[model samples]
Target: MKKFKKFLIWLVGIILVVLIAGAAYLHFSAYQPSTAANQAVKVAAEDNQETFFKAKQNKLTVIFYPGALVTPNSYAIWAKKVAQAGYTVKIVHFPLNMAFFKVKAADKVVNSNENYVVGGHSLGGAMAARYAHQSDNPHLKGIFFLGAYPDEKGRLDQKKLDVLSITASRDGVLNWSKYRQGKKYLPKTTEYYQIKGGNHGGFGSYGQQKGDRKATISNGRQQTIIAKKLIAWLRKIK
Candidate 1:
């Protein structure tokens, strides 16, 4: 009987060691980037033209939200360009950096508007999708996704109706693997724009910062070029 107890104790100790090791692996793994190893590149200042084509006489309004765990300042430059195009663009400030709650704030900020569009980066994009998915907001024109993916729970269904999905060719952050998931919610009518030298966090104000993470391109000129393209796309629909 004593022998059996000792053997059982030994077995328990072995199981415990394995469990601890597995947990350590998972914890460390989560800290690693989802993409390849590259230096965090700094982006350039915004020098795009101030010309903005007004889509509507009253002026089209857009609610812009940032990505998860990202600050609103990162996309400041992009917002300025969008707003410069004769559209009133509102960049959401998520105190918690959580897109879900941040989107709720956007709805309230945009309490009432005859013509309004919603869009964001990464998780922010998903938040916009959820907002437009609801049938109540008929004025919600559409959404733009920048290196953003839809949640597995069907919140990204808006892409099927009126959505624009843009991805940077060199962006490892939102690589093809991560982008493929968005396809399920994309409609045949949805438009796709591929930014040649863009990265996951390229378009925003972070353009000139090395940032806490690595980026695809650090060239200010290239980022500005793509920013111009993004503005052009917004104007095309205008």
Candidate 2:
């Protein structure tokens, strides 16, 4: 009995030491400054570009929701890209990760705009879909989901599904089985794009985590590519 107790104590001590060391390393690692506070900053587009933002004031509006526990600032760059592509972009922040909380916040920002395209990163994408599906807005353009899955419903409305776009990669946090099951509720024409080399957490709007610079660079490249494609897709529809 005494020997067993000693063994357990040694195991606990080893685990504690490892955890402390890892925490220290991560804290001291290369960390990028967060630009999350600049959520309202819009990116400038090319001259003579036929984007939705320039076409008319009543043009389609695209709203971006950040991932779980993330701020809208993380998706600012991506939102600006879409805005540049001609869609008026708005990034809505939820008080918490709950969609119920986000829905009310987003409602204030929508203001009866008919042509709205709602999208999000990770769990935020799921929240956006839930809002659009449950709302009475017929003018909603479409939904773009990034690294997220449709909720319990095997169905999103046909109108929204017609314009749905699912962008995910192997590294993303999607449960393919659950995602596939939800597809039954979506429009048969919904587009799906698999982002290569992307992770479920890394593709989020938030900036890179404090870690190896190489990993950060790789994730940044993938995210940039995803953002560009999103802008292109939004422009084509606008």
Candidate 3:
């Protein structure tokens, strides 16, 4: 019995060590923002407020969450494009660069008086859906996802929220089986799009992801397509 107890203790210690090592890797190996994304627009940062691209009129607001281990600035190019097209955009930074660390991070930046849409990429998108499912914000007009899907807990189908889900045809990082299963959680009216020749990393200005498939399209082309589709959707909402 003493020997068995010693083995159990050893196993527990090994597991804890592995968990800590993985967390450290995630924290240190986060994706870096591209130079073009950095130069595309001047992001506004305020104390305790989310980093944002502010439009002159602020006709609409979009609060975006970054993917796991992705730096918030990696999304600057996309946000800048959207903001120039006439909507205010804010990218919420997650603790330890993971949206799962704080699923309700968007709550800090959502303005009650402004019409807004909430969305995220990969894990971030899933968390955003979870937040929208539970939030009672009257100004939240839509939910957007980039290579991400809602989990069962979101109850979006029952709530019948306006949702847009965009995925790359060659995305290798996203689990197809899980994505298919999660589709049931979305409302019947959800609009879904598959960007041909695109890959998972094309949604942001971050360099290629470790396990993602090679994108046949240029990053610029992919982002432009995303911007056009998103702008069209925003116009409809407005």
Candidate 4:
């Protein structure tokens, strides 16, 4: 018993050390928002601090999460366009820019009385799916993913929620095998779309990622497609 306890303690200690070291590395190496992109935008929140793009008059809201190590501002430019299309868009900024730190962070931004959908980009998308599947919030009408998918344990196969998944044709950064495996976790009504010639990093304003392929389309062009898809999806749900 003593030997087993000691081994367990050592194992936990090693895991914590690795997590801390990885977080520290991400803190310094995280991708920053492009300076060329507009930095000024409307900020609105009841309790949570976030970047919000609110339509003058709107009923439904779409809460977005940033990808791991990505700045919330990276998504601001395109979010404004989506907001202009009608629905309110709120981008949640997570601690260390990692949604894994707070999978339920959207809870603070969500207004249960109002209609809403949740989605995220990359790691953020995966976490958003987990939040949508785990929460009993009836107002959560649907979810969307940008180069992301749900995890095995966070499956939404039995849920009635609408799901949309957006992927890039030239996205080398996404794990194709894992994404394929994750489809079994989505609901039967999930919709999938791909942006031709776009790379993974084009989903946000951030410059090229280390492993991502060079995008054939400009970032603005790719983001426009993403905004169109989101706007269309929101219209369908409402």
- Expressed as tens digits, the lDDT of each residue in 1-238 for candidate 4 is 9999999999999999999998799888888877644553434332345788887788679899989888887887678888888889889978888999899988887676988999999999999988988989888899999999899757899988999999999999999999999999998889999999999888898899889999999998998999999888888895
Checking candidate 2 for backbone clashes, the offending pairs are: 51-86, 52-86, 53-86, 172-200
lDDT at residue 136 of model 1 (Cα atoms): 67
For all candidates in order, the CA lDDT equals 0.58, 0.58, 0.86, 0.87
Each candidate's root-mean-square deviation in Å? 10.0, 9.8, 3.6, 4.1
C-alpha lDDT of residue 172 in model 2: 30
Query: Residue-wise lDDT of candidate 2 within 1-238, one digit each (tens)?
Result: 9999999999999999999986566444422224542432434232211111232343577766666655445555555555555667666645443344555445666657456777776667777777777766766667887766667542474654344454445443466677777666667777777766565555544454332122323545665776687766766564
Worst 10 residues of 3 by lDDT: 40-49
- Best model per lDDT: 4
State every prediction's TM-score relative to the real structure: 0.65, 0.67, 0.88, 0.87
Report the candidate with higher TM-score, 2 versus 4: 4
lDDT per residue as tens, model 1, 106-209: 56656464566677777788777766666366666667777776655535554434567777666656646757866777565767887676666665544322
Off by over 4 Å in 4: 1-24, 39-48
For residues 131-221, write the lDDT of model 3, one tens digit per residue: 9999887878889999999898765887746788999999989998999999999989889899999999999988899999999999888
TM-score between candidate 3 and the true structure: 0.88
The total of clashing pairs for model 3 equals: 0
Candidate 1: RMSD over Cα atoms? 10.0
Candidate 2 stretches greater than 4 Å from native: 1-58, 205-217
Weakest 10 consecutive residues, lDDT, candidate 1? Answer: 33-42
Clashing pairs in 1: 43-207, 43-208, 52-85, 74-205
List residue ranges in candidate 3 displaced over 4 A: 1-24, 41-43, 46-49
